[model samples]
Target: MSSAFEVRGGNRLQGEIVPQGAKNEALQIISAVMLTPEKVTISNIPDIVDVNLLIELLGDAGVRINRVSRDVCEFQADNIDLDYLQGPEFKKKSGRLRGSVMIAGPLLARFGKAFIPKPGGDKIGRRRLDTHIIGFERLGAKFIYDSDDNFFRLETNGLKGTYMLLDEPSVTGTANILMAAVMAEGTTTIYNAACEPYLQQLCRMLTRMGAKIQGIGSNMLIIEGVKYLGGCEHTMLPDMIEIGSFIGLAAMTQSEITIKNAGVEHLGIIPEKFRQLGINLEIRGNDIYIPSQETYEIQTFLDGSILTVSDHPWPGFTPDLLSIVLVVATQAKGSVMIHQKMFESRLFFVDKLIDMGAQIVLCDPHRAVVIGLGRQHALRGITMSSPDIRAGVSLLIAALSAEGKSTIQNIDQIDRGYQYIDERLRKLGADIRRV
Candidate 1:
């Protein structure tokens, strides 16, 4: 794979599509396998570029991993190779994916020291690791910053659980602290913890392995530090971001689709946001039903006022779904405001959509006003480069709805999260090809 994708437009996707396992959850859980040297089995792992790179990272670190089947793998981290951490290739792999930063806590917990490069992900905004560093500092880890080399070294005499409050609820930060806290010496109480489903799953897996944790679903977490964690079997949840993406896809192309085993319980306040956009979603058992509705209108607030869909911490609308919401709003009947509070630069993709004939007002860096031109204006196909993973997929969705075949380069950004996207969308009758 050349780390880019050529997307062909002018196809209406039509078929049943079940999303792959959650990439966000998979990364953390896979790293947690290093908490102990025993073999741990994880199921429902997504086959994606980032995951493949992570597997290679694990192998480089001397962790033994075996693929029992397509959806199952066993990992053993008994022998870690420290020599592998000194090269540019290692940092390159880690720097390309945000999940790479997550390994620091586990590696530090087990080895008492870890070396990590400055983490990287989408170029949309300044995704800070200060929250992560602060969390580790609460656990008594010492940090060294090398601005010249762009590397970070974390070491600690011993980890002790203390009363820590995150300045902001960063998802990866919570996971890092949870991993380090499990092996710490005393009780650690984390207030304002990010309780996203991925973090929740990581906490559950830790508990199953004999780590005592309380307040699993709230902003506060209590972890009783233990000596060692045992091996256990765990599975990653379905990707809610994918579910939201598919919802946008079905609406944009006017297609009927069903999302299976969507883990709706984890989608707090997500479906409600989509409903305001006049997109009807039906919940039947564990599956989601989206019928082909011709005219999707923007619904107003309870006071008959214009609505604003903003991102917040967990239990609030997710920052990941903001891109999809912005794209889907292009075809909606009325106007709505999108406030991307977490990442300042995430709203930049509106320019690409505006070039495609969507009416979007970028109100500063943190907000945008989307006055949907309805389905009357056909977005003409144009050559556009993907900016970020979520925005890349959102642009792909727009390209699918454009008048002619469109070309979107830099699809490697899209591939980081979505697994076999071309294949899965092809099954849904989407006319997308990779060259």
Candidate 2:
């Protein structure tokens, strides 16, 4: 059974909210616990659905898990049951999470074999495993795909490190290949790798575990093989996506919000993008303070042209926050174009905004023109279903800023990425309840 959120909009929310742990970082770091048999202590673990599901999968794989607190845990994979990977339970559980695919690298590196069924997650666009598979193949792992059961099997007598250039700067692919190459024979040089902050955190954690990796925050990485890895403690950075969402939320609702401990150092180009949208935000140390505004104007280019916001690799704007940006622009003073370069279906949620009286023109599957209403007319909420994680939160923000009452169905999508969002919003004076 699924649940929904019944939100009474038009409230000016005001409060200080702390962001949860980085979900993307937690997924990669938790899966990395399988690389060593020693105890690995990780703090700032987010209690969201997707992350908790990954922890459950790890526990089911026979990892010794100790929950120190709501946001901390210790993991030991000394007694993993290799046979469990062949069971139906593993297939059913692992197939539900896209993060399950990440374990293949650790398993293959440490145990010489890995098995995984087709993983599932948000259906935003075409997410291919070619980078991961090709990287593994370059490192001397034999790959076999079973189309009937939708399973992938990989094994290696011994992995020998080699040079490989990724076709794309895939974050998960880089993390996966990095974990595998750290334990292989000889040196592995990976060019065109992802250099996101989360990936850099992974490299630092691996370095603490005695892995020799160069180029922590660059597109190229060189890793020297090691015979074994030891355990180390790691702390997750505050989720930048959530910070971006809260910034957007503050703008959309015209509320005063302070996001505490936002990890602003890692939030490259995010604050500037929001500033470009004409939202007023102040960076007080690590905290982001968004002031309430009656109306904010969108900036035009110096050439007197419309502004365009698009997603790119790290140091560029994140694709995850583009949905929030699109939603926030609905009521600004000027027009802006949202170019969703990564995912084709991400812009489809604008129709829900359009239904709420937002002046938006969906030019194509990947582009939309949002003409700011400038609060000339308030949006009228209606019932809608969330399409994906980012889209779900974007819709929730839209509903919170709309007039009258609104119902958001498929809230599980929101829960997968956000922890107790309704409860947290309530602290900021939002009249939202789970139904």
Candidate 3:
């Protein structure tokens, strides 16, 4: 069923909200359960569409699943039906989810063979699987592509440890390679690996399951292969992207909002970047409190130049929150440049903002200059369609602050990442309805 959100704007929201579990981390961690046949208990799983679909796919493959609660589950892949990987049903289900590709590594490592269909996700840009395939080939896996059926087959007699330097620090690629390397013959050293907190969490969970990994939170990793892994329990971190979105939501709506248990320590440079945009936010232990305000100013650089926000690797600003930052800037008090360095199509949603009365210039596919309207002339509502996950929430934020009623279509894209967003927004006094 298709859905849309009809939002009546100009309402100030005030309340406390808790972020859901990390979506990116959950994808990697859930896929890792395939590495062992023992029962793996995972907690704090987000009740979102994508995660639920992945869990359903695992069940269809014969993994024993125990739904301990809505947010907790135990998975035992003792009797997986490997033949299901070649069926049309598996291809249909896996093709809808990009995270499905992560399963290939564990399947190849344990069973010496794996099948992966062409994966799909956000249409933000070209997310290639070359990094994953190239890493597998380096570890003694033979790769074959069936172009007619749009499938990838990987087989190996036995994977041997090797030294590999990734062309780019792809997060999912690094996780895929790490899962495969944990059970190989000798020793594997991966240079230029992604060191995101999500990757660190995966490493910690794998370590608890008897995987020998060195350098938990660094770019270089060394892993000594083991014969088998045991089952372990894992708790996911709070969604940093959702926390960032809440911060932006409060700023744009001029509302007082408190984010409970935001996992502040893990949010690298996110709050600081919002602070650079002159959004007033305070950290109280692990929680973040954003007070309602009339106006905020964008800070200029020390040399009295326009401040430019760009995405980089971890310990830097995350690319996922750039859309929220761009939307928040539309109502601020100065001009700034948003440089979406990672994905070219990310900034395309600025056209929708421009139609809503935001003073933005689409400089190119990768950059945009937003001149703050200062709330002197309020944005008027209009019907728009969400292009991707980040952009979808960004449009929701814009709609909540606009002058009148607005309709946002394609909310499935939004539901893919955020959990019960419309219901949560209503708790904070937002006039939004799902139709």
Which candidate leads the pack in lDDT?
3
Cα misplacement distance, residue 124 of candidate 1 (Å): 1.5
* TM-score for all models, in order of appearance: 0.96, 0.99, 0.99
lDDT of 1 by residue, 1-435 (tens): 454445556566676888788988888998898899888899999988788788878988889999988679999989888667656778777777677888888987877787778877778778788998988887889999989778898999889889999998888888988898899999999999999989999999999888999999899999999898888999889899999999988998888899889888888898888888999999888888999888799998889888899998888999989999999999899999999989878888889899988999998999999998799887877778888889999999998888877778888888888988988898888877887
Q: In model 2, state the lDDT of residue 28.
A: 97
lDDT tens readout by residue for model 3, 367-388: 9999999888888899999999
Relative to the true structure, how large is the alpha-carbon lDDT of every model?
0.87, 0.94, 0.95
Cα shift from native, residue 358, model 1 (Å): 0.9
- Provide the lowest-lDDT 10-residue window in model 2: 116-125
Please give the distance, in angstroms, between residue 321's alpha carbon in candidate 1 and its true position after superposition: 0.9
- For model 1 the local lDDT of residue 175 reads 91
Q: What value of lDDT does candidate 3 attain over all alpha carbons?
A: 0.95
